[model samples]
Each structure stands twice: as C-alpha cells, then as structure tokens.
Target: MDVFEALYTTRAMRRVKEDPIPDNIIKSMIDSAIRAPSGSNRQNWKFLVVTDKNIREKLSNIYRETWDYYINSFLNSAKDPGASSLKKQNDKDIETIRRISNSASWLAENYHKVPLLVLALSRNDPTGSSIYPAIWNLMLAARGHGIGTCLTTVMSFETEKVFEVLNIPNDKGWTLNATITAGYPLGKWGVAERKPVDDVTYLNTWGNKTNWNLEQPLWNY
Candidate 1:
C-alpha cells in the first residue's frame, strides 16, 4: 500500500470484525515497529502482543471499569452534568464528539472480542518520544495489511491490575503507555477529515500565517 494512502486512511477504527489476524502479519507489524527511531539509540521498549482469550477477558473488565470512571468523572466535573463538554460546541462538532464517544463506549464493552491487543511499554523515558513513533509504525504497518487499529490509554488508569494480569514486573520501571486494539475493520477505509494544515501551521513565527490555503487533505485515496 502507498504510504500516503496508509497515512490518510489509518483513522482510529474502534469497531472491527472478530476475524483473527495472521501471526505473520502481526510479526511484520512489530518488525516494522522496532525499526522506528529511539532516543540515544536505546530501544528500551517492549511490545506485548496479547491474543489469549482469558487474559483479554480480564483486561476487558478492567478497561470497562476505567472507561466508566473516566466518563463519570468528566460528566461530574463539567458545568452541565449532562452536556459532557458539548455545551458550547456547534452542531457539527457535537455530532463528531457524540460519534467518537459511542465508538469508544462500544470498544470498552467489546474489547475482549477485538482479536488482538498490543500493549506498548517503555522504560527510562520521561517523555514518550521513543515508543510512540514505534507504535505509530506498527499501526501504519497494520493499515498496509488491511488490519485496523485503535490506540487507547484508558487502561492506564488501573495499570496495577493490568500489569498483574499480564505478569509485567512492576519493579522493572516499565511504564505502560498505551494499548492498541487490532482487527479487520467492519467499515470502509477513507481519508480522515481534519482541520486544514494551513489553518494550524505558522510560517517560522508564531502568529504568521502560512497562507498555503490547504483546504482539503493532500492525499485523498
């Protein structure tokens, strides 16, 4: 697959088919992932590719607990308890938020059935400048092979339970950064819509506009 196509179409696919991804494809994804750059050439990262049904079920329970807590906390802290950060947003933005929330909730409920869960862990990196690039590489590689992935961190809220279930040694200083859920997507892949680059980019200076007028995505395929 073209790199540009992968870049444009690799959106967070939370809902996916239960079909199993081949072991070779998963290996290729991680092989591509480790090729990504790390700080000071110290690749202190571990990718735990989890496929066991029992382990996934345990993690799913913890994930659902964290997800519900997060949502409830956000609702309680917001000015309008029912609005959920949607009080002042326009109709389009509101719809987008709602769609994302629904997808996330669905994933929380069905995490064990997603076929694969990759836990990205790193050590001795205060900022996640090392492991995240590798994770992105893995996701892009999966996209190339028609596998969809969604990177999530809600499990981080209860890392102790996660580490216990996965048998990750807590004394090793490994920080659980993110969990990527992977499977064949149930929906069609398409370019993810986002704000125009020109709208977000500045020319050397902070307030100077680039005036590039990039109103649409550069890669549409």
Candidate 2:
C-alpha cells in the first residue's frame, strides 16, 4: 500500500484471529520499524516477542484486573448526576470509557489466543522524544503487511510484575514503552474522522490561519 493509503487506513485493531503470524512477517514489520528516525541515532529499542502459552495467560490476568479498575473509576465519576451540561459531558465520557473498558476486557480474556505479543522496550534513559515516532512506524508497517496491531500500555501498569515474570534484566533499563498484540484481522479497517486541519494549523504565527489547502492535491495534475 502507498504511504497515504496506509496512513488513512491504519486503525487500532483490538480483535484479531487466532492464527499465528509467520516469523518472517514479524521480522519484516520490525525491519520497517527500525528505519524510523531516532534521537542522535542512538537506536535504543528492543523488542520482546512472547508466544509462550503460560506467560500469555499470566499477563491476561493482570490485564483483566487493570481493565476492571478502569471501569470502576469511570462508573464512580458518572454517579454524580447534577446539571444538564454536566450530565451530558459525563455521559459522553462514560460512553467512551465503557467502550474502551469492554474492548480491554475482551483482550484480557482472549489475549492468550492471539498469535503474537510484542513488547517494545526503551533504554532506561531514552531521549524521551523519539520513542513514539518509532512506535507509530511499527503500527503503520503492520497495517501494510495485512497484520493487525494494537499499541497498548496496559502491561506498563504491572511493569514490575511483567519484568519478574518475563525474567527481564533490571540493569538493562528495559522499560516497556508499548505492547503490541498482533494477528490476522477478523474484519475491515478504515479511517476515523478527524478535526479539520484549519482548526489545528497556523501559517506563521499562533492563531493565524494556514493558507495551504489540504482539499487540493499536493501535486498539480
């Protein structure tokens, strides 16, 4: 797929089939990921691919606990129903929270069934700037390969436990930046609606409107 097509079509895929992803495919995705620019070319990224059934089951349990805590927090916040505006805002937030909680719960229950679990780790003292760009590249690359990936930080909530369980070395400074659960997708993917660029971009000064028109194609035909 073209860059634009991949950018537009890639979405967070939480649900995937149980089929295993080939090691060659996983390698290709990682190859694309490492090409992403990093701070001072430090290239301090490590990936841990977990396929062991026992470890997956243990992580799933932790994920479920974290998801439950998130749901309880959302419910507690929505319990206070006072003014109309307050109610509307809270209701919207509650709805989004509920959807995320449900999706996470599904993953928690079924993570063991996924083909691969990838943990992207960073150095103990990374530049703190280039990390996310590298992650974005990985997700986009996975999308291009017809593989679905979800960038989750749920495992970070139980980092110490994860480290202990996985036997990750402490001195390695192996902090989990993101966890990607990957497999073949069960359905189609599409672009999510975004705010108009005019609302966010400025030409030269803050608050000044950008003159460029995204509606028009970049190259004149």
- Best lDDT among the predictions, by candidate number: 1
Report per-prediction Cα RMSD to one decimal.
Answer: 2.7, 4.1
TM-score for each of the candidates: 0.92, 0.83
Task: Write one digit per residue (lDDT tens) for candidate 1, span 56-131.
Answer: 8999999999998986665444435456555445557656766788989999999989999999999999997799
Per-residue lDDT of model 2, residues 119-204, tens digit only:
88888444556667777888888998898888888778788888888888877677888888888998788764455677779978
**Clash number for every model?**
0, 0
Q: Score candidate 1 by lDDT.
A: 0.90
- How big is the positional error of residue 99 in model 1, measured in Å on the Cα after superposition? 2.4
Itemize residue pairs with steric clashes in candidate 2. Answer: none
- lDDT to native, each model: 0.90, 0.77
